[model samples]
Target chain A: MNIIVCIKQVPNTTQVRINPETNTLIREGVESVINPFDTYAIEEGVRIKDKTGGKVTVVTMGPPQAEDALREAISLGCDEAILVSDRKFAGSDTWATSYTLSQTIRKIKDYDIIICGKQASDGDTAQVGPGISAHLDIPQVTYVRKIEEISAGHAKVERLTEEGYEIIESKLPLVITVVKEINEPRMPSLKGKMRAKNAQVLKWNADDIECNVNDIGLNGSPTRVIKIFTPPPRKGGEILKGDTHEVVAKAADLLKNVIIG
Target chain B: MVDYLLTEEQKMIKELCHKIALEKIKPVAAEYDEKEEFPWPIVKILADSDVCGVYIPEQYGGMGAGIMGMAIATEELSWGCGGIALAFAATGLGTFPILLFGNDEQKKKYLPVIASGKKLAAFALTEAEAGSDAGSIKTTAKKDGDYYILNGTKQWITNGGEADIYSVVAITDKTKGARGATAFIVEKGTKGLEFGKKEKKLGIRASATREVIFTDCRVHKDNILSREGMGFIVAMKTFDSSRPGVAAQAVGIAQRALDEATAYAHQRKQFGQAISSFQGIQFMLADMATQVESARALVYSAARMIDAGSKDIAKVSAMCKLLASDTAMKVTTDAVQIFGGYGYMREYPVEKLMRDAKITQIYEGTNQIQRSVIAMNLIKELAKNK
Candidate 1:
């Protein structure tokens, strides 16, 4: 089995600071980490390769520095890494990003399964995974909580839903967006870290992947951010000090007024 | 934490162990300490991360970073929980004899298994009668045709029943006094080998301590370390290498106490102001910080000296163990003082740290024994110079 995992490099959310004046993220001095959710994707991809006796190839599309994230994925047992980077890819939205990745996968041209996190923490759009499936015209399973079974050319998985879960059976050549419930990620071993340190990540750009010039960068993106701002802080509610019955009636009356208004 | 000018590999070991400490060990430290349960889960985590072989050579399937790497890993894990970290550190203590004295076949046979972290190893020299006076151990290893029958009880043995391999020193020929002793590799499941009930400890309760009993337990003559009548030398050499590890554990425990006290002092209010603002608290914090840093410096230097293949390291190694363990005791006490009433309560972390700090001074040979070793080295060096 040829397994490919898509990952993203995002600012470590805990250290992120927003500039109140510019209404933009303050990126300077912030550490970059592999997206928290994408770790699950990397782990799932590695697990599949472990069971099927194949190689796990981790791919990411970002600036040159994003190689660190790919290297980290390698340290976590990914067999190979590919970096999709280009100046023209700047400001690409979910559609363009997915398109570029799909083109990169096509260039590889030998994948039985593609794995991705349900969403990137920074964007929270949860679109790129499904978008890649759509671009490739392959069956996709999103929010996969468990891979119940996998064989020669088929897989059974549990798809998490609002109610509970659904068992979905899909043939080979499928894209899966995994949830945290899928598996617990392993820490990198010294041997793996040494491998990551010396491993060379294959770098490609817009031209290398043969992406359509019109559908490869900022111009290709369909969505645009008009403005970014922090939401207004919620105000504290008034305390209802009285007997239980009285407080309950007062709370009901206030809630009714707000709902009616 | 001041940068000790560690190499890149050492830094990686520090970072990875720190991550394990924060993400895995810290959360469960309290429960394990309370329940007195061995930290098998944490041990498994350490094994999965390949932390078990930080000091072992690459030929034995280790990272080959040496003693400094081991120190860095120990300090970080102990920062999370000293007791939990002992499961790893004590294994190092047990494996050192093999690393330092075992022949080629023994190293090939044992080090790889230990390096893989599939099994834990323990040192069993301590007995009911042999605390500081290690020369008097009565566990007899009587020679048979091809095997030695071991008969004795080892007390206060860390990782006793749980460890798969034991490096034990016993009297091979009682008539020769200290020279009569011999060190042997004894597997856990050998017939006549049994373990007594676990002892309740004031601290490091997450670690297992029990009596290792051998009743007519037979060990192959090939298992003898560096031939017979060299048990004392083997035991001493193992201590020389492993003492730094114990010191690192002390430094880790001390550093944790300082961190907890500092964080608490900033938020704790007194006289309508943060307690940390007062000169009294400031002085205490300053002293604690200074002591912890100094202890860490001594430990790193001693560990580096050993790794650098310095021949005369017994004195410095003993000094590091003595100073760091003493520092841990003082700093932890001060940390509890900073926490005041809350420090005395079990609900707070400092009290447990205080409890944990006590054993570092007591174990791996008492502070008194360390001072004696240092003094003996000092006198011998002076005599040689004269």
Candidate 2:
């Protein structure tokens, strides 16, 4: 099995602050960390490789500094790392980002499984993983909480749902977006850190992956962010003041009105 | 938080240990303390992360960062919980004799297993009759053919019942006094080796303390550490190397106390103002911070000197242990003072820190013994000058 894990480098959400005047994120002086969710994706990929004896290649799309995230993944037991970076790749939205990653994976060619986090902390859209699956025209199972069994050409997994879960089986060369229930990530060992320090991260540009010029970067993106602002604080709900019988009748009437409306 | 100019590897060790302390150890520290249980789960986590090998040689499946690495690791882990950190630090104390004196075959046989964290090791030097007067230990190892039969009991031994390997000191020749003593390796399951019930303690309650007993327990001659009649030298040398680790634990406890006190003072209100606004509280915080920082400096300096293989380390090592332990005791008490009535309650954290701080001053040789060692070194230096 050749596993591929896609990750993102995002500002640590705990330390992020919004610039009220500009209505934009104040990225200055903020520490960058792997998108919190991506940790589970990397862990699952490593797990799969460890069980079946395969290689885990972690890939990320960002500036050169994103190489640090790849190294971190390596320190966490990812076998190989690739940094997909290019100046032209700037300002890409979920669609373009997923398209670029799919092309990069296509170039790698021998992957049996591709795993991604359900969503990135910076962008809670939860679209990139499915977008990659669509571009590659492969089956995808999102919100996967566990891998029940996996073999040479098939995998059985549990997909988390609002009420419960659904068991889903998919053939080889499929995509999966994992949830936190998948596994608890392990800490990096000293030996792993030493290997990460010296490991050479393969860097690929848009042209290196043979991406279409018109379908890569800001111009290629379909969605746009017109403005960014913090939502206003929620107002308190109205409380009924009366005897228990009267209050119950009034609450029933209000709930009935809401349902009817 | 002053910059000590750490190497990249050292910084990595510090960062990883801090993460483990915060994320894994701190949350369960209180529960373990309450249950008085050995932290085997946390120890397993440390082993999985290869932290058990931080001080061992790389050839023996360790990181080989030496005493400096061990000190850094001990401080960070102790910050999470002093008692929980003992499982690792006590193992370091036991392994020091083997690392310092074990022949090639012994190191090959034991260090790897210890470095792998498959087994914990312990040092046994104290006995019912030998507390500060270590030369008077009653445990005797009589030679019979190719084996030495050990008899008597060792008291208040850390990691006694739990550790898989033990470095025990016993009297081989009564007439030779200190020189009559010898050190030997004793496996936990050896015939006639037994452990007494665990002793209750005022602090570091999570750490196990028990009496290690021997009754005609035979250890092969090959298990002897160095030559015969070198037990006291081995014990003293081992202390010289391990005292910095104890000091690091003290610095960690003091630092945690200072942190808790400072954070509390900023939020605690009295007279319609934060207690931090009062000069009295500010001065106390200042003194605590200063003491913690100085203690940390001394520990790191002493640890670095030992790592650099300095021959004249006994004086500095004793000084660091003395200063750091005393600082931990005083600072923790002041932290409780800052917490006021809340600090006295079991519900609060400062009390536990105070309790934990008391043990550092008494263990790895008491603060009094540490002072004596420093004075003796000074006197010897004076004699050399004369």
Candidate 3:
């Protein structure tokens, strides 16, 4: 079993602060951390590899600093890591991002499973995982709470739903977007940290993955954010004072007057 | 650019320790302090997390992040609970003698068990007669055939009864004075070895402190660390290497106090405005934050020097410990002042932090001892120049 996990680097929410004057994020002192949801995905991929006896590879798409996320994944028992980074990939929307990731997977050419977090916390857009599956033409499961079982040719999982969960069985070569309920991510062991320190991360740019320049970055993105603003603060409501009967009478009178007006 | 930034690995270690401290240790800290319990649950978490193994070498199944890593972890954990932090930090204190002086066989036999967190280790040098003067400890190890008989007692030994391995200093030759003392690896279950009274302490109650009594305790001759009569050397070397960890603990305590005071000052109100608006309170907070940052800088620099394999680190290590612990004491007291009446109550965190801050000044050689060590080294350096 060869498992590949996709992870993302996001600003630590605890430390993020907004600049009031510019209405933009104050990123100067903010620290970057692996997306909390992606931790579970990495853990699930590593767990599958541990049980089935194969390698776990972690991949991420961002700037050069995103290598930290991949190395962190490697520290948690991933056998290999890849950084898919290029200036061309900047500002790519969910579709373009998924396409780029699928192209990288196609280049790797041998993977039994692809795991990802249901959503990136910063974007809250849960489309990338399913989008990757759509691009790869592989079976995909979203909101997986648990991996019930995985055998030679099939995988069983508990897919979360509004009403409890549903046990879904899918064939091999599947993509899974895991929820936080999947597994607790383990800390890097002493040996694991040393291994991560020495492990070489394979870096792939747009040209390296044979990505089309026309379908990447802001030019390829279909959606654009024209404005971002905080909602207005809520005003206090009027209180109907006095006894219940009197309050009801006054409220009724006000409602009738407003309706008539 | 003279950058004082932590390495990527050090940052990760700090983050891990901070998480564990907040999630695992903080909730239970007050309870343990109130009950004066030994904090076994926290010990279990530290062991399982490989926090206990931070200072050990890689071959022994440890992160081998050295003093800098240990200091970073110590600071973060101490921020949550100084008493609980001591439980983990003391293990490094115990294990350093072995790492610095233990021969191949000893390292192989002892380090793996400790690095795996299978057992705890302790350093016992202080006795009834010896406090700052460690050279006068009365414990004796008399060689007889294949074993050396150890007799006497160790007082105020941290992790005393709970530890499985002990690095004890004892007199091997009465005529040789301090040079006569030797360090030995005495297993906990050895016949005639027993734990004496457990001391009730004012602060850091979660950490265990007790007397270790050895009544004609038998020890294998092979357990001697380095060689005979190297006991003082081992003890001093271990302290030199570990003082930065203690300093880090102080920095953590001070930082915690500063954070609590700042948060409280902003929300607390007087004269229709937050007390934080007052210039008096602002100055106090400014002082607290400055001292905490200064201590952190000194502690990190000393730890980095040790990690860089600097031989002449005694002066800086002692200065770090002295300044940081003093800073902790002052900052915590001022935090209580900032909190006013509420800070006096145990329901709030500042009072607990204040209590915890007092011990950093007293332990790992008192702040007075640290100052002397620093001054003596300074005088010696001046003499060399003359």
Best by DockQ: 2
Residue B295, candidate 1: alpha-carbon lDDT: 91
User: TM-scores of all models?
Assistant: 0.96, 0.97, 0.83
lDDT of 3 by residue, B163-224 (tens): 88999999999999879989998889999789987799888889889999999999988999
Worst 10 residues of 1 chain B by lDDT: B1-10
**Cα RMSD for candidates in order:** 2.0, 1.6, 5.1
Separately for all candidates shown, the number of backbone clashes (residues 3 or more apart, or on different chains) is 0, 0, 0
List candidate 2 stretches off by more than 4 Å: A18-25, A238-248
| Model 3: per-residue Cα lDDT at residue B340 | 98
DockQ of each: 0.69, 0.71, 0.24
Model 3's C-alpha root-mean-square deviation from the true structure amounts to 5.1
Chain A TM per candidate, in order of listing? 0.92, 0.95, 0.88
- lDDT per residue (tens digit) for residues B20-136 in model 1: 999999999999999999999998988888899989999999989898999989999999999999999999999999999999999999999889899999999999999999998
The whole-model lDDT of each prediction reads 0.94, 0.94, 0.89
Model 3's i-RMS, to one decimal, reads 2.6
